[model samples]
Target chain A: MIILIDKKGFVLSLDAAVAVVLVTIILMGSAFFFLKTNETFIVNMQMLRVGSDITAVLQADGTLDTLDPLQIKSGIEEILPISYNMRMLINSTASSSIIIVETESAQTNKKFIVAGKRFFYAVQGGNAYPSAVTYEVWPK
Target chain B: MKKAVFFTLSLTMFAFIVLSLSFIFAGNAATDDARFMELASINRIYDLDTSLQNSFSKIFSLDSEMTYTASTTEAIFQQKIPFNFTRLNNSFNNLRNFAIYNDKNVQVGLLPNNVSLRVSQAGIVNWQNISKNITEFMRTNSTPKSYSFIIDFFEINITSCSSSSASGNFSFSVAATGGNGTSCNQTLSINPLQDASVEISLGTKSLTVLFSNYSASVNARDNKVALTSRINYADTGVKPKIFLESKINITVPGLIAKKYGDLRIA
Candidate 1:
């Protein structure tokens, strides 16, 4: 029979609880957005790394130096994962470039794409020739 | 009422703090990610540069090896240098996107016109065309040690004056002079002579020499030579994937010898 409660205190407590809930909802929304963007960024970085490694190995093996398409194809096949698609643009001159090699995996409609480029030296006709190789990669 | 206000203020402050901390962490994560990517790109560039340097050194080494072996006669040179030479050539064919821009006809001496050898990936060894190119280049440059082998004589007989069609891979004219100062121009063929004695008279002196018992010295000056070389992988049917259309100026030193001599062709 001694149930004496302060209406003011009850009202304050309820209001505080509502504020906390709203703030929590906002925090969660922002965190979700940020984390999702971070994941996407990380994926792109990984793609870039893979592309760079492929070009480096080809250059080191003298396959890039000779412009051997068959060897280059085999090298790429060994390095790239089965789930990814890759295309290469090879050009001798900076201006009026040409598409030397282009390849894609069985899966199409890739959701993400990244590209990396590097220059390599090629010897042909008893001369040293310089060329630029660009690789475009994406997950299937 | 005052307590309620205070509670609301504290809750708002806590939420802001949480939000601010998360933003800061996100920023740091983004910055770290960008930095990592930049570092990776730089590393790749360095690797590519190093690879190019190593390849260049290999090419230079091959060029030196060929230069040192130039003293061997043409036949030996042809027989031995193809393996190393093909490797040298294969290096050129490996680049897929390579371009060479040699606008000026700068005489890159590595493939000087005087060095007659053009080997394609199809395993075509055209020595005669190469010889013609080299002879013209040497004549233009007036380079010393520019010797050519136009003909090789294995055996020949001249019991009587007779002319026959040239059947050997190479043909050349020979000049003979007896001790008596009588000089005669003789033609030698690669076919073995059949039981014949040759006589030459010079200035009131005649020397008889048996064709079968004599050794011949062969010298070529600005001559064309042709030989067929089978590439090991030609049967594999792998065509050259890349053909470099650009003209680059690459100076390969000591690619061709100044002179080749002392060829005793039996």
Candidate 2:
């Protein structure tokens, strides 16, 4: 009788052990899920800040005068604590259409005309992703 | 009894495993969030750069004629033939540390309300501090020229600001090249070959500009001067980044017609 009782007690304990193991597995799974969600949220926030700065700098007309390559570099350096690298490029593009303006002369049969007003400035930059910024300007 | 002891031990191990896993997952989540935020900020900067470029293009298209007219008495005109030294001085004041080099390579430090007695056809202008003489020269001798204008922008790193050192130590440069007149044929070329260049460096980031050159050629009998231009940029920086470049081109149809006549009547 005593042996039987001991045997029954051991089986019950075994069942309890199995139940505890199951609970631990569930806890670990939950923790992983929480970690992943939080990470996604933080990344999104960083991206937002970067976008804001870019917009602010570009929208500033007075800032354009200050768009010296060196100054821009400095600005990036100022913001480097945030872990971002910045670059800018302004190039003239051959993609242009000629415009011809003609005027009939009042004094003679000759007409006055102007031509060759085709040219563009290409502005491009690279970040985590490659992007191009183009500024087109005609002759003065 | 042995069976009971074994079962108890197994349950304890299981509980420990569960707790450890949970902690690991939680820690990972936080790290992931940080990484994501960093990437987002970088993207935002790029987007702004793209938008700025688009805006500049629109403006350039609307004002393809890069001409700005000012009377002899106009502030810009009264400054001089080769440059409006006064305006240049003012512009430098707005920048943290400004410097200019003329064809002669003479460095002229521009100071607020300051004037210099040195007289020359072309020389450098440096704006390290404000001075009285520099101001006078800008008002009296500065002149606007008919051809190209070289504008430089510098960025100074503000390491620290106190009574001892008010300004930052580091700087980077960006230049805008604009041209006018009959002799400015190469300056206005639209091809990539005709563009000029400026060197820029910020910390570890660096790049070079190959300005687009645009050119237009008419009959020798025609009075209109030929024009050409080229513009180009390349990334020599550590990471890919975006930036904005804005330029305005104005063409005075009436003025060109009066000066060159049929030469521009293409």
Candidate 3:
């Protein structure tokens, strides 16, 4: 009825144009899928950022120097969001490194775990000592 | 047939373009992950440096170290700086897989002995006791201007009295005497040091002399940024997450002074 076909039964008009356009669409769709953001990695980075910020807050407020695990624990809980959980470990040259502070049942296995740490001087037994604070965070 | 060939060729070109774009996107994603891990390691390295500096400064304020002459002061400061470095190194060795820390990752001064105090942040304890003593001594004396208090190596002399106001503002001047005087001549920066921070109070039943940087002569806030920080990093058997064992001699910039001349109100 009005097919645009060449003498050799080849499509040379609208059909060819439509085929080219369809191929372009498929390629574009695949490109988008390929470029879909790696959100898991981004979330991990964000979790690490939150962990670092909490430690920074602790150090800034001077609660870290007290070496009182209770004060440090409360300090972390006050700043951490409700949707996430945290666990803090303190390591000092004066003492063995251990989990000094934590949120409610912060299990690292609940989700993908992101960890962060901080370092500073804290006085214990009348001596200023070097100490490291490590924190692990996960979504609840 | 020519048209078929042309359409096929066009499709192939589109496929190539899309594949190239995907690779570029993937490459960006990888570098970003590496960059974040790098950033975390660098932060740890910086904390290691500050711990060493603070330890050095705190030693000067120790009751044990205060009795030394200038030579002994230098000796003690030099000898004591190594105390924290090894402990910190071993503690940090636990995190090497993160590739942000390793053995001897952060160094202050020189390595293998010769660790000098890059920035001294010694603080005098029993401050409340000393300040109260000074105020009480000055209040009862007929000529208050002649009053001076010496704590082992440091002397606080009160003179050139304009007037004695309430206990809200104060100032200090320090000059090193009878030694090499390596760093005592530099204008003091008192710690608990949030810039332009802290109120030094001296009080009695009726009189108080306070020192705040708000006054003209107290220790002005100064911040030091160390750019020569070299961090050694190595990680192997991981692709794109980190590089092969390579030395990352990065010149860390904007490292703020951790602690110096701490004035604790004990």
lDDT of 2 by residue, A1-140 (tens): 78867678666776776777677667757766885587546544543444355424543432323334455445544543344333333221221322111111122333211111111122334101112222211111
Scored by TM against the true chain B, the candidates give 0.25, 0.27, 0.27
Better of 1 and 2 by lDDT: 1
Summarize candidate 1's per-residue lDDT along A31-135 as a digit string, tens digits.
Answer: 776687778777777777788778778876767766766677777888887867677777654335464654563436547767756566665666665566777
By lDDT, the best candidate is 1
Give the per-residue lDDT of model 3 (tens digit) for B176-214. Answer: 222122212212233211122222211111112233322
- In model 1, state the lDDT of residue A109: 59
Q: Which lDDT tens digits does candidate 1 get at residues B1-266?
A: 78778877787788778767667656765676566556545544443434334443445344423321111112122222112344444444443224123211111113222223322232222232232222111111111121122211112221232233334422233344323333445454433322223344322423332222112222122222221111122231333221111222322222321111111111
Interface RMSD of 2: 10.3
Interface RMSD for model 1 amounts to 4.7
lDDT of 1 at B169: 28
Residue by residue across A1-140, what tens digits does model 3's lDDT show? 35453343344434555665765676566555534545655666678778877877787677887877899889988988887788888876556556467786546454776775556567666656556677788888
**Rank list by TM-score:** 3, 1, 2
Error of 2 at B11 (Å): 4.3
Better of 1 and 3 by lDDT: 1
RMSD (CA, Å), each prediction: 17.8, 25.4, 17.0
Query: Against the hidden true structure, what lDDT does model 3 obtain?
Result: 0.41
